[model samples]
Target: MHLIIPNWAGVPANIGALATLRSGGVSQGPYDDGNGGGGLNIGAHVEDAPQAVVLNRALLGVLLPASPLWLTQVHGHHVVDAGEVDNVPGAVEADAAIATRPGVVCAIQTADCLPVLFADVNGRVVGAAHAGWRGLQGGVLQNTVARMRASGAGPIVAWLGAAIGPGKFEVGADVLQAFTDTAQAPEAAVGASAEMTPAARMAQTQACFTPIAQRPSKYLADIYQLARIALGQAGVTQIYGGGLCTVTDINCYSYRRDRVTGRMASLIWLK
Candidate 1:
């Protein structure tokens, strides 16, 4: 399993960018490593052993910036400042996290939802967002962008983590409508009506289905495209790494593919 991380233009060169894949752990059964067997499954709530999860997390910490701020992610639009979590562990509940000060890591865990990392050119501010269709349509992306703006960060580099890319995500008319119904929500597509509509929604959604072709009423939803649209709404034109399909990649966990699968954490921090 190869871990992938993409750095955006707004992020400073000194800052490190990385994302972990399913490898190096003590979990047995389906979560097993290819050759080593019994891979690292870091989520405590999963069927994987709690001690194994702790061990996996410890192994991950070798490269992480201190301990990562893990959120109790509920697919909502809430964005919290992890910089404020100075007290203890497992005390934060947020769908999105931002770290403006250095030495702090803003992390997000997701099996299929897009894990978006944001940072400014000066490395003064960094952020992570767990953007499923609901959170994206709600306002998580815009909320993160607003927070980054407040920190006097410019360019606002964004890296799209591994997610259910367009090819594997199938959605009904409701999801097609999710990004378009901005009046019902906010900063959603947050763009023009001509580009995103009931008519073109299917075409737009079907552009990425590889092995799994587009179905009738539903279309293959591209989390990357949706994220780029959201980032565009956030006035962030320079985005990177929208090319991963977690659902298709067996090495990665995909809630869409397996509802009970463990999650992968995408983390970013200032050096």
Candidate 2:
């Protein structure tokens, strides 16, 4: 099983974090690894055989302290406590989860969408957020950071997992407008000094979308840059682990590249 361990120096020794690649599991067909091996598609909602997903998750579970708290991602900004998720009936519909207790894994599944993992530098808490374009524009990462801070976390650091790269992620004017049109400061702007003025923030956001001359009303949006701006606005400055492009990297899954593709998981927890 190949896993991308986050190379983040800000993470405390007690915290554990890893992003799963498409390789290593029992899934087949569209969920199969791009190189013809079984894939590690842990997403239960992706229409893969239920039994295969079970086995794949079981394989992943062997490396974790406990089973991951998987949420039904809605591409929204809702954040939840990972420890409280299991007590709820049915599947939780949050796009991000924070874990204050040890061994409580906060997991986010994605193919093209960004999976961001967060942790307190002091190892007090950990979190995972699924940030598709919608969720990113909707404030998912800020909400996760706010929840972690509310739970007593200190100086949080984040690691950006694999996602569609700027070169391959094409977006329309509406997608660009969704970010540029909003000037609200991040919900978790920790200090007044760290806050970017509404105009500055909008300018930073506009820079993330580059117009594609060949395609009218189209642009190449850099999800990583957008994430960095958002995290910076939220007062999280020590960020790491970006530039892995799912669409171009065969080891990772890419829904945009393959319409019927498997999903990879990015997970974090306190040991």
Candidate 3:
């Protein structure tokens, strides 16, 4: 199956990370690759054929050390320990997962939503978070970094995976207000503005949302910039991989582009 090995520098040799593309599997119909071939749809809860998902996951399993710990993402800020839910029978409800031990893969499935992979400089711990707009606004990345630090990680770095690009991600006034309100909140300025004044930080956050002239209260929201602001708030500055756009990149799946579609997975683990 096609995969994207993160090009992050200073990543320890023992940390394994990859983002899957939508190709090289047995799924058909809407789940098939955009080129009319089989797709590597890894999400089992997207109404894809059960047997097809099984076959596709098996195809992906050949490249990994063990089965991935999948979560029932709710676009919330809950973070879970991968080792605790790796082999569990039922679905674990969380937006992010962290793994401290080797062979326990932390995975996040996404279509148009952003998938972020995390690793410390020393590879002591790794994490994966599914950050849609809701999750981003809810502080998922900050929570993930916090949990990683608590689990003995140091100086974390993050890599953004495929998602809808800012040019194509249209949003309403509520979306703009949500971020603005958060940026102006007293607690939000504490760590995020440590390097700058609260006014400057607010400007940085507001700059991510550009007004759409044709649409009265709509704006083009840059998910990547929003994520950077969130990470900055958590004291993580070394970040990478934010240019890929699932909506326009045929190699990846986009739920917004196609209402009914499969999902791609971003995974990270210690070797």
Highest-TM-score candidate: 3
What value does the lDDT take at residue 253 in candidate 1? 75
**Highest lDDT, which number?**
3
Error of 3 at 132 (Å): 0.6
Candidate 2 Cα misplacement greater than 4 A, ranges: 87-90, 184-197
Worst 10 residues of 2 by lDDT: 184-193
- Better model by TM-score, 1 or 3? 3
Instruction: Write down the RMSD of candidate 3 (Cα, Å).
Output: 1.2
Residues 56-92 of candidate 3: C-alpha lDDT, one tens digit per residue: 8888888899998878899999999999764652378
Compared with the true structure, what per-residue lDDT tens digits does model 1 show for residues 1-271?
Answer: 3577685555667677688777666777556553446566667666777787888889888887788887888888888888787625457777888777777888788778889988787677788899988998787898998988887776677889888876668777676665555533432344442346444544553343333345566667667876776677678887888777887787887777777667677888877
lDDT of each: 0.73, 0.87, 0.90
What TM-score, computed on C-alpha atoms, does each candidate reach?
A: 0.85, 0.94, 0.97
Would you list the rank order by TM-score, best first? 3, 2, 1
The residue-level lDDT of candidate 1 at 14 comes to: 61
- Model 3 earns a TM-score of 0.97
